[model samples]
Target: MVEGRPVGRVGDVDWLLTGSGDPVTVFAHGFGGGISDTRPLGSGVDGTRVFLSFRGHGGSGPLPPDWTYDTLADDVRQVADLHGATRAVGASLGAGALTRLVADEPERFERLVLFLPAVLDEPRPAEARGRFVALADALDADDEDRLASVVALEVPAEFSGSAAARTYVRQRTVALRAPGMREALRRLPALTAVPSADALRALRAPTSVIGCVGDPLHPASVAEALADAVPNAILHVYPQPGVLWNQRGDLRRRISEFLNSR
Candidate 1:
């Protein structure tokens, strides 16, 4: 059974746990996502899988007034330490947080799996950032129409064609209509300072990256760049468009193979 509780005051971060073993695998979801986003990953993996909701997302409390990658990483470490995590898998912003955690405390995580991580040398396109910011502002203003527009813009192009995507967007929009969402998005700018290519390359733990060919948020070239930088890092490219969050089977196969190899 998955247990939910508070690991720290930033918010009541719930830890979802399954299985029993030494090498606990912790699941970290992306921006605007929660522990439920990791349900597929947990189902795919065989051992202990712990899913955490980042500060301001899901059941976690609002993000600290001042948030940074270090703070996010520290939160992850605290939860991992509490659960004795031996391995970790993170997607997008979560991947950024895990990277910093492994770098700061190498002994804590035995292996790392990063999915469609967001690390761009240049700032995100002004138009895209503006759209997200506008949505956040609208949410703060309690403007439902503007908030829905923002959700539409945030949805990946690939998801546009799927019924699941439509349902997800509606559900997420409703969830974000609450008061704390704007504050959460306000804290997102801090996530822009992702680890440099050299820093990711220097990581000591065995690493693997999963890339989707057409995710605007996390371009495939970024994965290629990291694979080039890190020694022995495995890169798996999927033909599917958008992020790997929706591609459970492919991601599971690649991650399982990589972890077992180590």
Candidate 2:
């Protein structure tokens, strides 16, 4: 079962630490997502894995009144330091937090994984901000159906009618109905993860950047740009957006291989 007891706060942020051994792998989930959402990729990996949710995210504390990607990186740093982790993994918004963390401290981590990164050095277009804003509005209104509708826009069209998609959207909608969720979605989409490409160029860790074609929310171009900008980064482009469903084994094996590389 995927569960964790509240073992108190780390760096004023709540998180769950699991596994054992050296080379601990810390996980940061996307916005409005719980650690369970990231466990699929981190499972069976070498060494220990610790998952940290941002101040307002996952099951963490209430969202701070004033915080950005850089501020959130402090939370990541605290968790990694406490565990003596040499590797870290992030998805979407978490990817943003990690990028900010590494940009400021290039050698903070020995290895890094950015899965389905949503943004890089710049803020996405105005149109791209609509979904998140819509979500925030829906959440403020306490409209579950509206929240589901906004999530549906993020899922691939081909899978929209499937049972898995319904369950996925439902789970997301429920998880997002938290105290500070609306405020987060409202402020985040407008913020940039890092100031410029120079932020990526300073990275000194061996990194893996993974993305897929069909996910408009997390574009492949952003992933490609991150790979190009980082000095020692490798890129992986999955053929479809539903990589967790279609490329599960391949991805699991790839993460293991990359994390275990000599």
Candidate 3:
């Protein structure tokens, strides 16, 4: 249903391939996300794009008991191998997974783009953890009102107050009500830890890290720290999460410029 179809499976995971050209780009979405989350970035690129659903999310299979960032990263590596992809873009947990991939196999990718990376040196914030748990509870109860409240706490204040934003949140929550999602949400805290500082510092690819303000779970500070650690990384912090929705044209331009650069 996303922009591509099921080309094939990679180690119990489903992958979608779209567009066509050299230097295939892989787009991985965040926790509780699917191919749709990274659709914007996938379409922004001029070359081939491969979109993957992490274990238990989107079109992927149910979560395995041994699932970890390393496991998910291996799945990503498999997708790249299938298409001979040389570049990747990921957000939040997806970004974390890509981090692990590039760290383990630096030669697998030529360029990397990470957005709103949810991991850093610090532990997961208590409030953010609580929100995920609450959302799981809401989903189990099929409580739209409760889910809206939980999602609102994480959105930018301005966006949360908008009727359209609230509607979007509720609709998104409803669409995400897939089997095994509750278990995936529960395991998120453990699966989202950032790769080791040494691993980040050792990255050899041209990388760009984007973070947004007003997102407690994925703070700009985390992006700043990553940019500081990766020798060749550049950091871009959006003033607010709302800007991502209202100013997508600008965002597309920024991402296009990055992907097209030499």
Candidate 4:
């Protein structure tokens, strides 16, 4: 069973530390997601799992009065120190957080795995942000139809081709139908800043980035850019699209190899 404990309390932010084993692997979920999202990957890995649900995501509590990725990195550091994690895996937004964490404290993590990281170093399109806000509002209002429409718009096109992918989407959508999601989405503007390429290149930790072919939001170019920026960082392109987290076996193998090497 996955064990859990409260690590740090930053205002309303209460970071949770969980799992077992030496050289623990800390996991940070994507935007709007929580510790639960990392369960699958954590289960697949060998070491103890340390999962942190950022403020406004999952059971961690509401957003801080003022929030930024740097602050989130501090939260990650506190959680890692509390749980004694020597490796870290971050998915999507979490990946971006890990980048900042490893950049600031290279000795903390032995290995890092980033899945569909959001590191554009540029502003995302205004229309995309507007659509996300609208969806969040619709979710808050309990407008199911509007929520479904927003999901259709935001979900990558490849999700339509696979039954498993559709099922996963259905499950996630149901989970997101809950109340606090609107507030989580409202924090997107603050979470959207991209890390500098130079900073990424200077990272000393052994790192790997996984990209999906069909994910519109995190295209292959983004992963390639990250790989190029990070010294000796390996880039893996999965046949599937988007950040489903369950489509490929190569991800597990790569992470295992990277961690074992350290």
Candidate 5:
């Protein structure tokens, strides 16, 4: 069991390497999230973990004006290729990135975990997009109070106003400090993860699609659809969106068992 290490940059991506053995797992945090957001989720899982922050998210470089899904996927692709990751885990924005990458390069990873998937082929709902826009607006205004409030709204009622939720919100707010992230947030709303579900059928890796009941942003339907499309995907739908907040131990165990089993 290796402790965490300092973050290093490869091109535009900020990557943190932890553990040190076979079955390397690359973790891509959600949009407006950093490595701290996802690192603890897989803490109980063994093997080397390469945690990466997409551009303008986790100490990574600022986003290019025209950045899109391809840029995000390429960020994950870059870290995975460089680290020789045997498995990968993605949450929301990161899950979208993995979907695009694996669709084109099916054999890139041996195992996969798509947790809290936000979208697939179709564009997300306007309400979801609106939420992102609101977040960006708050961030752009540099309103810490508003940003924290907006972030807190994303937390499920199961963990609403809890100490853990506060910390989680802080992480998201702190991550938004990355340069030029407001544009990244505004641009992402209109983009679908991949071209089509037909593209995902090409995926060769066994996948674990995890979702929850009430998250409008990362809807459970998307996770179900992803699991249905992937030839060999296991579905895990937690009762609440705050699975990471209240059910963390269970979530970590599931992630550990799945990644270790491969």
Candidate 6:
């Protein structure tokens, strides 16, 4: 559907394209994020931006029963091939997939930026899994208040006290109302566990990591572990999620500088 390359089904997943230039960059969104979540990072970049909505996210199709990090990474690889993207950035679960992709096919990407990776060292707790299940239940029932309540529990203590943060959580949670969103949330924990830290040490691409404070689900330690494991990796830790909107400029500068340096 776009000018440069064929835009349609890649295996079973669908991708939306944006921007136009050389040396394409792909922006992969977090667990709850869709194409819109990628807009801020992709907008000012000086190249084509491919925003991939993973299976069951945004406009993409439902996830297969066997879906895992490898499946998601392969989907990203398909998009990278379609657009010839050598530089890419991803957040949370999206970042986990990108890490897996680079580990599997290092030649596919020249550089990468990982933000708030959800991949953790320990197995996901039953409490957290229960929270996601409850979120899906609330979403299935279309109970906005219940959905917000479940999400609020995960918000960092600092952000929970602020009105803007609550509003932002509500706004972000609305995306779960989309068709197939429940499947994505329910499967997220398993996906996060794959492409383990030991597996990521093999990645060769230069990478930069961004960590946010006060988010229990995406702790700063995960980012630190990744930066230490991957070759040629750097990290920047932000204060909290509430400042992310105003901090886009800093994020953009760092990602661009890192990608351009190589």
Predicted structure with the largest TM-score when compared to the true one: 5
lDDT by residue for model 5 (98-168), tens: 99889888988899999899999998988799888888989878899998888888887767777978888
Structural similarity to truth (TM-score) of each candidate: 0.83, 0.92, 0.89, 0.81, 0.93, 0.84
Give each model's whole-structure lDDT: 0.69, 0.82, 0.77, 0.69, 0.86, 0.75
User: lDDT, candidate 3, residue 258?
Assistant: 90
Cα deviation at 70, candidate 5, in Å, is: 1.0
Q: Candidate 6 overall Cα lDDT vs. reference?
A: 0.75
Write down the lDDT that model 5 would get. Answer: 0.86
The digit string of per-residue lDDT tens for model 1 on 165-210 reads 6777777787676556677666565454345656655567778887
Error of 6 at 257 (Å): 2.1
What's the residue-level lDDT of 23 in candidate 3?
68
Q: Give one digit per residue, the lDDT tens place, for model 6 in 1-262.
A: 5343444567767777766778799888877777666767765677688888787675577777667787788778888888899899998778888877877676677788998786744545565567778998998888888898887775555667688777768767876776667876787665554435776666777889989876666777778888988888888989876335557788877777776674
lDDT of 4 by residue, 1-262 (tens): 2346645554545555555567788888877677767766665677677778776665566656566778678767877777688889888778877877776675677788888876546544455467667878877788876776676665566556467556655666775764556665676654543456776656777788888775655666777777787786888888766445456465666666776674
The total number of steric clashes, by the backbone 3 Å criterion, in model 6 comes to: 0
Residue pairs that clash (backbone atoms under 3 angstroms), model 6: none
Top lDDT: which candidate number?
A: 5
Query: When superposed on Cα atoms, how far off is each prediction in RMSD?
Result: 3.2, 1.9, 2.3, 3.5, 2.2, 3.5
lDDT of 3: 0.77
**TM-score quality measure for candidate 3:** 0.89
For candidate 1, the lDDT comes to: 0.69
Minimal lDDT window, size 10, model 2: 1-10
